[model samples]
Target: MSEQQKTVALEAELDALRREVQRLRARNAELEADRGFPGRLVDALPSLVYVLDLEERRYVYWNRELAELAGGNIGAAAGPLRGDGLSSMFHPDDIGRIEGYRARVAASESGEQATVEYRARGRDGGFRWFLERGVALGRDPEGSGRRMLGSAHDITAHKHTEQMLERSESLLHAFLEYTPSMMVAVDVEGRLLLVNREIESYYGMSREELLGKVVYDLLPPAASASIRKANDEIAAAGQPGASEHVLVYPDGPRNYLSTKFPIRDAEGKLYAVGTVSVDISRTKQAEAERAEMQRRLIEMQQATIQELITPLLPLARGVVAMPIVGTVDPARAEQILTTLLEGIAARKARIAILDITGVKGVDAHVAQSLVGAARAAGLLGTRVVLTGIKPQIAQTLTMAGADLSGIVTKGTLESGIAYALRARRRS
Candidate 1:
């Protein structure tokens, strides 16, 4: 046959098996001219072509490719294969489906074809996927097809690639849907390309509404400005940007920590941007609460120290004395006066003693505070006695013009307590 005629004949068989009925009709007229050409051409085709005996479950006629696929060269004897021969090469999981496919093909109409996908075990013991197009070569006497012509192409690589893509897509979908963080992908123009379920739920927008919307338009003005600045920073620096922003919702303002990064092509050119945002309002509230608690605790501690610095002791039933230690500020001096009067009222004390032995240099303000304490004690039916006074503090009180007329003086705290007890006995 001429090359052009050979090419035409080869395409007719390899590519036109789906129209096997029409091809078989024309094949009879060309059989004499084609002679051995069809056999050699079928053997040269990439796919495996076979005419099977459906009733016996064996190949009646197959190409050289089927022989190699069926392990003829590896171990099987060099001849036409026998009973259960071709069916045994199919995977165990698919062995049942093969019988169904053959039954369907046998029952098919003259021009109809049955397409099925199945895995078949190769000679090397690995299973490979096959996409087969089979049809009835001829029908039996009972109006059922008994012979089938099939063209099978190996599709294992395509199947594996599709499976991997599907798995990756499923994993990405699950992460976006279930993760707590809000994630979004936007094109360079700031249009939203992808948004997770969390993002949609957080913003109270449906996926249909959120998609294709500009991210900047959806966010509050301040938040969008911050996001825009962060995007610009990363775009210039070629790194990810992280920032904290406040978004005002219908309820209130919420704090969010967001990280923005560029999605780049393999050549390192930016194409889009991705953002992951997490709400930090609870964390900020916790920090504020901790700080407030610390402030309150410090105030409580200072109040406790004020009491510890000036401890009022009841020397007798009708008298009390407080030994003031350390330097006394006006605030502490006022605290001292308040404690003295309260102690006198609570104990009904007639005599109160102030110990200034531990007092540092008293300023004019502190001296006046002490003088006021003496006058206030006297009004409460208590005589305020100054005890353990240093000479410099006495000089300071005199120089400050503090009145000492009603206030009694003593050399020591023990002496003051003795005088108070004796005075109480006399009264």
Candidate 2:
């Protein structure tokens, strides 16, 4: 080849090489820009970002976010870290979990990722929940060896939310336990789901043991049927209903007033039934006593009217006599006067005898009542004979200064009857 031709070929080669060098420089600039962009963004990010070398078992590369989290700059944070050294920040309680996760990551050689939630100690000496995720980078070209790159994300907020929900549930259960009335919750099928402490007496069993059992199982057949019917109605209506029932417990039957209502969810769907029972045994007993007293009062009134009116039904021309017994108090005196006056008018008797043969004693007020009744009878045209005055009664009458001037007195009921008959004949 000629020298000049070789020079031309060299120049051509030089031009092509220069073009290639310029292209290479442009590409390098783009790559540098991209690298610095990601690095800066990652360093300034609020969340920690990291790459783990599973084989070395340490954080390979970390951003400034992680460095700040470790209480240092990136250089200082990475200086002491070899592979797998990030485990040092794991809480003691989570060390076993971290070791297990590391083992899982190392064993995974298929380029797949492993994720776990674990606790890590912050620089502030507090533990934070983290979700650790790792994937094998390139331990094997066929993805059959363990070489992992991993990152952890803080999930403390989510953990806190879960813990708060658990606490709220515990508080609710505690409140139910301490409530006074017997409270119970049952599923749609009428199986008991929850029962409060007060239900222990009603069911005759521990609340724990009663769960999942049908309410009918603890009640008498008749009472269970009635309660079940009411519950069904309330559930169907999605409202409240109340009933009084007798619960047969181990101790025996006890009365209770039970109120039942349906429990609904936010969307207005029927979920379960809630019930509260109040002990009404005392109130029931009081009501019964009131009823008995009323009945006795009615009976007494009827007996009084019957005794006063029965003897007057058949009127005769002969005399009618009323014999009173027992100590004569003011109330008894009033009753005797009322009976004698009413009987004289009813029977149209010309003469009537008021005998206190069995009377052992009398007060001054009673003697005065007797004299007044005799005067009232005389005005009604029926001659009154006051009979059966014993010695004591006579003494009391004298002491009372009661005027018996026109009242006829006899010592015995027999004499009074005889005197009444003679007076009736004379009239």
Candidate 3:
């Protein structure tokens, strides 16, 4: 009875063990399917997945995406990339960066991660930008990197956009810097967001010091206020306007013709003010100098004309003859008197003959001027002999109540000269 019972129990135990083995195999199959699902997902992804055995300094695995991009399995024994180094895939300009990032990730502790963006050359002879992220996966026995898991995303489109933006900004900066005028951009709050080289040089400051500073911080109070007002008007009107500004420099006061306009975004909203200040100091100073020179030139021309009109000529010893030609106004009359006295004193003339043969018309001022000249000459001990007195002029002078009775009058210049000679003989 004991042998039979033992045999039956053993058979039952064997059956239960078989069932357990079958259940365990089923569970293992399920777990393998789960793992295979993730592997399939990785292969199907657009991003390239890879594993690097840093201990051996070689890439251990790469997904299908990388194999397709590289034209072969990156890790397969018969693949085109089988023995090639990972650095060969990178662009020459990016090799150093890729190598540096790899080294940094390898030196990091487990679970450490790093990201880098670089250009990778494909088998198609095209370069594409990749934003690759690497994670350290534990270390080897020698305290060196064992494995690194990384994913590379093709960021070529994003990089292109970034480059385009950078180029646009660079072009704008160059245009502003090389412009002849001082260009400045300020936000609505009056903070300086951008300034050209001219502005920096004009203010004697650097971009770092000027940027983000208020407009009033760098300029004189009056200039700042004026600029602010102009900016406000431009912003309010959404149109360009101009104003004059004076900036005191180390050398002297400099004038500027500033044109200010509003800068709008794509939505046509005013966000900044653009100012272009053209230096007008030299132009203004030159104009002022030209005007002064013109004044001096006019004075010189008048003096030459006056000398031409009145000439006191020496006729005989101690006698001077002056002839008035053309029209004689009060100024010319005064000039005539001055020249007569100077000649009389220079020649020590006791007799002076005044000629008016070319006289056209004589006004009251001219009459008074003649009378005044005679009295002045008499005081200098010179007897003035008036000549070439037209009857009409004499009547006009007499009717005008001009007192010329003390002056000796002659009808002709020849008579005056004769009388002067006779007077000289008497002297």
Best by TM-score: 1
**Model 3 agreement with the true structure over 1-427: per-residue lDDT tens digits:** 6999999999999999999999999999999999899878999999989887766666667788887776533534453232245556678898778778878888887787899999887657788899999988878777767778889999989999999999999999888879888889999999999998988888778999999999877778888887788888899999998999888888888899998989999998999999888999999999999999999999999878766778778888888888887888877787888888887888888888888878898898887787788889889988888898888888878888887766888999888888888877887
Candidate 1 error regions (>4 Å): 1-67, 73-85, 92-117, 130-158, 230-262, 265-268, 279-290, 314-318, 329-350, 359-382, 391-406, 423-427
lDDT: worst 10-residue window of model 1:
72-81
Q: Tens digits of per-residue lDDT for model 1 on 1-427?
A: 9999999999888766768877887888698658978999999998989887777666678887877887654236555455376666778788778778878888888979898889987657888999999999877779887778999999999999999999999998998999898898888778888999988887789888999998898877878888877877777777887889887768899888999888999998997888888999999999999999999999999878877987888877787889988888988888998888888898998888887877877898899999899899999988888998888888888899999999989988888888888998998
List lDDT for all candidates, in order.
0.84, 0.77, 0.84
> What is model 1's C-alpha RMSD?
12.3
Candidate 2 Cα errors over 4 Å, as ranges = 1-48, 54-57, 73-80, 83-89, 109-116, 121-125, 138-146, 168-182, 188-192, 195-243, 259-262, 266-268, 278-427
What's the C-alpha lDDT at position 359 in model 1? Answer: 81
| lDDT of candidate 1 at residue 343, scale 0 to 100 | 81
Of 1 and 2, the candidate ranking higher by lDDT: 1
Clashing pairs counted in every model: 1, 5, 0
Alpha-carbon RMSD, each predicted model? 12.3, 12.3, 9.8
> Judged by lDDT against the true structure, how good is candidate 1?
0.84
